[model samples]
Target: MNSSPSVKIVSKCFVKPKTILEESKKPYYLSPWDFAMLSVHYIQKGLLFQKPLHSTDTLLDKLRESLAIALVHFYPLAGRLSAQINENTKSYSVFVDCSNSPGAGFIYATSEAVNHDGRTMSLLTVQVTELVDGIFIGLSINHAMGDGTSFWNFFSAWSEIFQAQESNKTDELYLKNPPVLKRYIPQGYGPLFSLPYSHPDEFIRTYESPILKERIFCFSSETIRLLKAKINQVCGTTSISSFQSLTAVIWRCITRARRLPIERETSCRLAADNRGRMYPPLPRDYFGNCLSALRTAAKAGVLLENDLGWAALKVHQAVADHTSEKVTIMIDQWLKSPFIYHIDRLFEPMSVMMGSSPRFDKYGCEFGMGKALTLRSGYAHKFDGKVSAYPGREGGGSIDLEVCLVPQFMEALESDEEFMSLVYF
Candidate 1:
């Protein structure tokens, strides 16, 4: 692993919206998915090109300038979250006060190391580092603002602006698709963020954990191909995809490494994107939390004792079950009790929160200089079982994973022969 340079904080401030909104655009309600993330920050790190820039001041100025422009389109991100209480029910719902009340937070820092990989992330909290030659931009957006898709949409927009300015094409810098801000609720369904039960404090009571060890593991295209073929051969089916194959293998391997009680139920919670899973589909640039979680669970003994293909089938089935009807039903269910996710189990040993999608182009994020050296979360997502998967930077049908686990289980995972054979440090 490459060592990251020492980073020193230069400044930290909020980047407010450059343009003001009309009185009609002051407040926006968070969707049920967005409301669920009220207590947390969605932190992401991006590494700029390695070549040295003119100066730190120059780089920071450009960043702040582009951010201000980006905020014009994503103005709600510059707003603060507030709640309104219902005296009759004694419950409150959260909404984004988009009256330019506050701005997105920004930090400037320098690192001694050349590259900041997953190895350098803090187990305690979200952190960002920069190098003399390159800068690492860390974003800490409130989770209630959007999901991964929304995060990237805003980021890509920023990059587009930066790219245009860097190339002196500011006049041509226009958003192809502006964010769709229309809030959607199922017919006959009441408000999703009903209070008391959906209170931010109440949700935080679930899944809060102590520090956990996080590491990134890369799997090449050939290894993934072989795993998929082997699973197909065993199961006599060709329908399984590379993602299902890899996810199945990793899940089983982690279970074996944990060495949990054989009969205990172990669950894999997959964060399913419902962008096109709706009846008519959402806008391509729909800016909100539109995620549906699909879960697959089995006894530890059953998962580990079967052939790899058997576990892969479970994953395939779990994904296949998420039809359009189920997605609407999920929304209906959420409207009934939006705040309760039973996420208390997520902090337990037997559960995993699988996020980040291979379908999204993580490596294509360009801030005018070049593609990012790497993209990662600022903090660990799960204590014992969290997995974030992305397409490999190598770009030949490969995969990469950011895994967080308990210390002992991580040690076991490090030494597991079958798991390590396909993994690169």
Candidate 2:
């Protein structure tokens, strides 16, 4: 790693947007945490090595050229959003900050051994606090734009552009016509409708709670596959995939640890990306959020009443239901409703959690040197969180997981033999 002095410059292009101010109704209501999340890159920093010598200006020019291509689809990076709410209306502004920084304020270095994986993963590290390095880059869109899958597709496109690769393959997957946002008047009048109880401020305050994360030791892919096969053998069902089996086992383990009454009920929130699943499959390159949540509930009685095989079957069915068109439509409706207006409030009281699978592998984020040795989100939010398994640096089928949970739960899980067996085995 090389060190360099910070550079600060002012450019008219970086100014804030008027839309943001109008929508927030407050000139300065932007959340620092949100802004930081939006701005952070997946690969915080990178090491690059080349033949002779290249001027810093040349590198900067190359970076700018690539960014312009990337910004064509990801317009959000080009500007910041502001909101304004008053008696007559709620408006937002999108201001562009034209100011320049002392350039990419950070040190630059290269090593002969540092391998360049091509342009897609060759982005240099973004300079942020060391603590924030491991977290995922969160973008807070209007929720009106699209879903998580759409966002992933966009990132893939941007990656292709950065690599100077053809985007035709990705373009074919997205909708030919861009999505149009539908406008609706809130049934209730006044600023009350605009003010979500769980405001952006609260989100920033409790974003890093310990209860939101938990650590599970890595497991070998072979072991996971074996476990899946064993589960299938016991259940006599070939339809269930390894991911479904693992999810079932995880759910059961968490339930046992919590020791809720056998009759009590609990739910796990699962996110599904609707890219390839859509009729005219969404563009694999469309950038924006295209994620939807599916809730799976288990009554303590139902779990305890059945053997592991039966429980796994139940979990499988629940997950299947989530992928149904009906479920997708329902989720779409909810996201666009008034209830979503207070989403921040709902997240706080809810025991919502996530279990991402397979998708982690696709984040193949490389910025010249090579794919990231590790990829993780910056901080644990209010909800309990976990990423799906990914290949470890060692090159075996080992699984790498990042989890956030309450401190107490974490302590218990760390020492619990049963939990360890499930996680490690």
Best-fitting candidate, scored by TM-score: 1
Off by over 4 Å in 2: 1-65, 82-86, 89-213, 276-281, 331-336, 341-352, 360-363, 380-382, 385-398, 422-425
- Candidate 1 lDDT, tens digit per residue, 1-425? 11234445557666766767684266676676665554443445454465435665776687788888888788777766566666677676666666635466665532212011111221011123456566566554455566778777777788788777787886667886678876665666445466564334555543355667889899999988988899999999999999889888789989988898998999877888888888999887898888876889899999988988998899999999999999878777767665544445434566766787776766666765577777666542455688988888888888889898888888999999989998865
Q: What are the root-mean-square deviations of the candidates from the true structure over C-alphas?
A: 5.6, 10.1
390 Cα displacement, candidate 2 (Å): 4.5
Tell me how far the alpha carbon of residue 58 in candidate 2 is from the true structure, in angstroms, after superposition: 8.3
Candidate 2 Cα deviation (angstroms), residue 94: 9.6
Name the weakest run of 10 consecutive residues (lDDT summed) in model 1: 114-123
Give lDDT: candidate 1, residue 344: 51
TM-score of each: 0.87, 0.61
